[model samples]
Target: MSRTELLRLVFAQIFLHATMTGLRLAAPLLALSKGYSAGAVGALIALFALSQIFLAIPAGKYADHHGVRRPMGFAVLAAAVALVLATAFPTIPVLCLGAMLTGAAAGITVIVLQRHIGRAATSNAQRKQFFSWLAIAPAISNFIGPFGAGLIIDHAGQASGDLLAYRICFAVLAVLPLLTWLLVMRVRELPFEPYDPKAAPTHAWDLLKSANFRYILFVNWLQSASWDIHSFLVPILGYERGLSASTIGTILGAFALAAALIRMALPVIAARYSEKRVIAASCIITVGVFAIYPMVSHAAEMVVCAIVLGASLGCVQPMVMSLLTQVTPAHRQGEALGIRLMFINASSFLMPMVAGSFGALIGVGAVFWVVASIVAVGTPVVGKIQLRDNEMPPEKNL
Candidate 1:
C-alpha cells in the first residue's frame, strides 16, 4: 500500500477509536444518571472489554482470510449502530448492548488495521515508522473523545441528568464512523494473499509456546496495565488533593499530549535504541512515576508526573508491535495480533475492578505503591527480552 493509503487508514482509525472512547466516557455517566449503582456502571465498562476479548481472535482470523477493508467496513458499521442504539434508546439495556457492540467493533478494527500495516511494510524500518504513526491516533483520540463529550454534556446541562446532551454526544459520535465507513469504501485495498482453508490453521496457544513471543506478550500486558491504572487513578488522586474537575482533566490531558508528542518522536528514538532497551527504560520510568504519584499533592506536580508517565507509557505500544511482528511468522500476523489484543482486552477488562478494590481496601496510595512494586519486579524481565540480530533492520525514514 502507498503511504497516502496508509495515512487514510490511520485517519479512519482515529475517528473510530475516538467514537469508542467518547462512548466509554459517556456510558457510565449516563448510567449513573439513570439510577444505576457504581457496580452497575463498572459492569457496563467491563461489558465492552469482554466483547473485545471474545471477538478479537475470531475477527483477526476472519481478516486474515478475507481482507482488512471488509472487517474495517463492518467495524465502522457496528460502531455506527452502537451510537444509534445509545442515542435512540437511552436506556441501560440498550446502552449496555451498544457498549458491547462498540467494543467488538474497536477490537476488530484494531486487529485488522494492525495486520494491514504489518503486511504493508516491506522492511523493519518502515514497520517501526508506520506503527509509531499509527499509535498516535489513539493518543490523540483519547483526548478528543472525552473532552468533546464533556463539552457537549456540559452545554446540554448535566446538572439534572440531562439526557439530551448525552444523546447529542452519541449523535456526534455516530457520524464519525459513518464518515469513516465512506472513507474505507474509497480507499484502495492493500495486497494480501487470502487465507486458504486447505492449509492447516495455527492455534493461538501454539503461538504462546515461543519463549520470546511469550515474554513480549507479558511485557505488553504490563504496559497495558500501566496505562489503565494511570487513567483510572489520576482523577481519584487529583480529587483527593482537592483539585477541581477541570484541573484534573487538564492533568490527564497533559499526560495524553505528552504521549502524542513522544509518539511523534519515536522513530528517531527507536533509530538509536533497541526495542528491548527502550521498553525496559519505559518500565523503569513507569515504576518511578507510580512511586511518585502517591506523594504529589499539587496539581502542577501531578502534571509533571503525568507527563513523565505518559511519555514512558507511550513508548510501549509501537515497540511491542515491532517486536511481536518480528517474532511471529508473516502468515499468522493477524492471529498474533489477535492474541495480543485478547491479552490487552482481558487486562483492560479486569484491571479496573482490581484497582478499584485495592484502592477501597488499602487506600489509593497503596494502589499506586502496589503497581510500582509490580513494575519494579518486572524491570529485569523486560530488560532480558532476547531477539535475533536481524529482527530490527537498519533505520530509514519513510
Candidate 2:
C-alpha cells in the first residue's frame, strides 16, 4: 500500500469503527425509548447476529472469489441504508431488520479488510504492525463512541426527543462509509489467483476439521463472550448500582481508554512473547482482573480494575489475528477467518442477553462473577493451538 493509501485506510477504518461503536451505544437506548423491556434489548442484540452467523461463509467466499474492494463498498452502502431504515421507522421489527442487515454487511467487511491487511503486509513484523494500527480503529470508537452517544441522548432526553439524537448519530455514521467508499476507490487491487472450483474445498465445512483452528476459534468465542458481558452489561449494571448516567459513561470511557493503550503496546508485547504465550498470558491476566471485580467497593478502585481488565483483554484479538495468518493458507484466509468469526459473533451475540437475564433473575453482581468464570475456562485451552503444516514460527523481534 502506498503512503497515501495507507493513510486513507487508516482514516476510513477510524470513521467506520467509530460509527459502529456509536450505533452500538445507541441501540439499547433507542430500544428502551420505544418501550422495549430488558428482554427486548437482548433480542435486539441477538437479532443482529442471526444473519451474521448464517451468512459469514458465503460473504467470505464472495470476497475471495471477487476482490475485497467491491464487497466492502457494497457492505458500506448497505450499512448506510440500514441506518436510515433504523432511524426512519423505529420499531422492534424494523430495528431487527436494520441490525440484521448491518451485521451481515459487517461480516463481509471484516474478512475483506483482514485479507487486505494480510496481503498488504510483507512480513510477520509488518503484519503485526499493520494489525496493531488496525486495532486503533476499535480503540478510538470504544473510547469516543459511547460518550458521543451519551452526549446525544443527554441532549435529547431518552423519553421525549431522543429519536432525533439517534437520527443524528446514524446520519453522522453514514458519512464514514461514504468516505470509505471514496478512499478505497483509488487503491490498486491485490492480485489473486483464480478461484478454481476443483481446487477449492467443496464446502466451508472442511475448514472446521482442523483441531488447532477449532481450539483457537473457541478461544475467540470465549474471549468475546467475556468482553460482551462487559460491553452490554456495564451500562445496565452501573445504572442498577446507583451510578449516574454520566458516571457510568465515565467508567466506560476509562475502560476503553485503557484498552486503546493496551492495543497500542501490543506490537511491542508481541515482539517479546511468542504469539501463543501472549494470548495465554493475556487471558490469565484478564481472568484475574475480572475475578477481582466482585470484591471492589470504591468507584475509583472499580475504575482501576476496569482499566486492568481492558489492558489485558484488548491484546488478544491482534495476537489472534497474527496467529490466524500463520495457521491458515493464503487462499483459505477468508474461509478460516469467517469460520472463526462465526463462533466469535455467536458468543458476542448470545452471551450478553444471557448475562442480562441472569442479572435480572439473580443480581447484577453475579454478571461479573459469571463472566470471570467464563474467561478462566480459556486459559487451559489456549495452549492447544499450533500453526499449520507449512507455517513458520513467529520471527524473533524482541
Candidate 3:
C-alpha cells in the first residue's frame, strides 16, 4: 500500500471504530433513560465486549487465511445490519444485540487492518511507523463516536433522551460502516501465506508460550489498563469534586487530544527508541500521574494530569505493535494479533466491574493506587524480553 492508500485505510478504520463506540454510548444511555438500574446498564455495556472476547481468535484466523478485503467485507455487512436494526427498533433487546454485533464487527475489521498495515513494511522501524500512523485512528474515533452521538441525542430531536433522538444517532452510526466499505472495498488484497500440508496449525494461546510474546502482551495490557483507569475513574473523581458533566467531558477530551497529538508525532520518530524503553518510561509516567490524581481538586489541574497521562499511554500501542510483528512468526501474525485483541477486550470488559466493586468496597483512589502499583512492579521485566532476527525475506510496501 502506498502512503495514500494507508491513509485512506486509516479513515476507513476511524469510521468503523466510531460506529461501534457511538452505538456503545447510545445503547447504555437509552437503557438508563428507560429507568433501567445501574446494574442493568452495566450488563448492557458488558455485551459490547462479550462477543469480541469469544470471536477474536477466529476473526484473526479468518484474516490470516483471507487477508484484508474479505474479512472487512463480512465485517461491514455485520456492522451495517447491526446498527440499522438498532435504528429501526431502538429497544433494549435490539440495542443488546446491536452492541454485540457492532463490537465484534469493529474488532474483526481492526484486527485485519492491523495485520495488513503491520505487514506492509519491510523493517521493524518501518512497521513501527506504520502502526504509529494507524494508532491515531482510535484516538480520533473514541472522541468522534461518543461526542457525535451525544450531540445528536441532545440536539437532533424535540427532547433529550427521547426514542427519536436515539434512533437518529443509531441511523447515523449505521451509515459509518457503509462509509468504511466505500473507502476500502476496491483496495488491492495483499498476498496471504499458503497453508503447509505437513506443518500443523498453531493455537493462538501457543503464542503466549514465547517469553518475548508474553512480555509484550503483558506490557501492552499494563499500559492499556492505565488508559482505561484514567477514563473510568476521572469522571467519578470529578463528580465527587463537584464538577459538572461538561467539565468532566472537557477533561477527558483534553486527554484524548493529547494522546492523538503524541501519536501523530510518533511515526516520524519511532525508529529512534526501543519499544521496551518506551513502555517502561510510559509505565513510570503513568504511575506518577495516578499517584497525584486523587489530589487534583480543580478542573485545570486534572486536565494537566490527563494530558500527561495520555501522552504517556499514547506511545505504547505502536511500540507494542512494532514489537508484536517482530516477535511472532510471519504466518501466524494474525493469530498473534487476535490474541492481543482478546486480552485487551477481556481487560476492558472485566476491569470496570472489578474496579466498581472495589471502589464501592474501599474507594476509587485505592483502585488507581492498586493498578499503578502493579504496573510499577512489572516495569522491570521490560529489560528481560529478548528478540530474534526474522528469517522471512524483506517484504515490499505491500
Candidate 4:
C-alpha cells in the first residue's frame, strides 16, 4: 500500500471507532432519558456485550473465509444502518436493537483490523507500531465520543422538546462506516494457504489443551472482565457517590484520556521489554487498582485510581495480540484469533450480568471487590506464558 493509503486507512479507522464509541457511551443515557428504569438501561447496555459472546468467532471465521475487507465492510455498514435506525425511531426496543447490531459489527471490525494489520506491516517494528496505533484509535474515540455525545444531548435537551441531540449523534455515527468501507477497499489482500476440506474444525477445547494457549485466552478473558467492570460500574458508582452528571462525565473522559496516552506509549514499552513482561506487569497493576478502588471515597482519589487503571489495562490487549500471533501456526492464525476473541467476548457478556447482580444486591460498590479478585487471579497465570524460541518469528528477535 502507498503511504497515503496507509494514512487514509488510519484516519478511516479513527472515524469508525469514534462513532462506535459514541453510540456505546450514549446508549445508557439515551435509555435513561427515554424513561427506562436503571435495570432496563443496564440490560440495553449489556445487550452490546452479550451479542459478542457468540458473534465473535463467527465473525472471525467469516473474515477468514472471505477476505477481511468484505466482513470489515459489512460490519461498518451494519453499524451505520443500526445507528441510523435508532435515530429515526428512538424507542427502547429499537435502541436495544441498535446497540446489539453495533456490538456485533464492532466485534467483526476488531478481527478484520487485526487480520489486515497482521498482513499489511512488513516488519516486527512496523507491526508493533501498527498495533499501538490500533490501540490509540479506540482510546481517542472513547474519550471524544462520549464527551461529544454529552454536549450534544445537554444542549438539545435544553433547546428542544425532542432528544434530538443524541439522534444527531447517531446520525453522524451512521456516516463513519462508509468511510471505513471505502478505505478498506484499497487494502491489498494478504496471502493465505487454503483450509483443507477434510480437516476437522478447531475446537476451543483443543485450543485450550495447550497450557500456554489457555493462559493466553485466560489473560484475554480477565482483561475483558476488568474492562467490563469499570465501564459498566463506574457510572453507577458515580451516581451513588452523588456526583453531578457532568462531573461523572468528566471523570470518565479523564479515564479514557489516560487509556489513550498509555496506548500511545505501548510501542515504546514493547520495544524495550518482551510483550509477556508487559502483560504480567500490567496485570499486577490492574490487581492493585481494582482492589483499592472500592475503598476510595473522593472523586480526586477515584480519578488518580482511574489513571493507573487506564495505564495498566490499556497495554494488555495489544500485547496479548502480539503474543498470540507468535504462538499459533501461520496457517491457523485466523481461527486461533477467532477462538481468543470469543473468550474475550464471552467474558464481556457474562461479567456485566455477574457484576450487575453484585451491584444490585450488595450495592454498586461491591463490584470493585468482585472485579479485583478476577484480575488478581490472573497475575500468576500471566507469568506462565512462554514464547518458545521456535515459535518466535525471526524478525521479532532483532
lDDT by residue (tens digit), candidate 3, 170-271: 999999999999998867777897656686876777777777788888898998777877788889999989999999999998998999999999987687
lDDT of 1 by residue, 275-367 (tens): 888899999899999998999799999999999998999999998988888777665678889999999988887787799999999999999
* Better candidate number, 1 or 2, judged by lDDT: 1
Q: lDDT tens digits, residues 29-131, model 2?
A: 7888777799888777676668878888877777667776778887888778877776676656776777777677666767777777876777676777677
- Report each candidate's C-alpha RMSD, comma-separated, in the order given: 4.1, 4.6, 3.4, 4.0
Best first by TM-score, ranked: 3, 1, 4, 2
Model 2 regions more than 4 Å off: 2-4, 25-31, 34-38, 86-93, 143-169, 195-201, 232-248, 356-377, 388-398
lDDT of 4 by residue, 314-333 (tens): 88888777766666655455
Q: What lDDT score belongs to each candidate, Candidate 1 first?
A: 0.84, 0.72, 0.86, 0.74
Tell me the TM-score of model 1: 0.89
Model 3: CA > 4 A from native: 159-161, 194-199, 388-398
> Relative to the unseen true structure, what is the C-alpha lDDT of residue 326 in candidate 4, on a scale of 0 to 100?
67
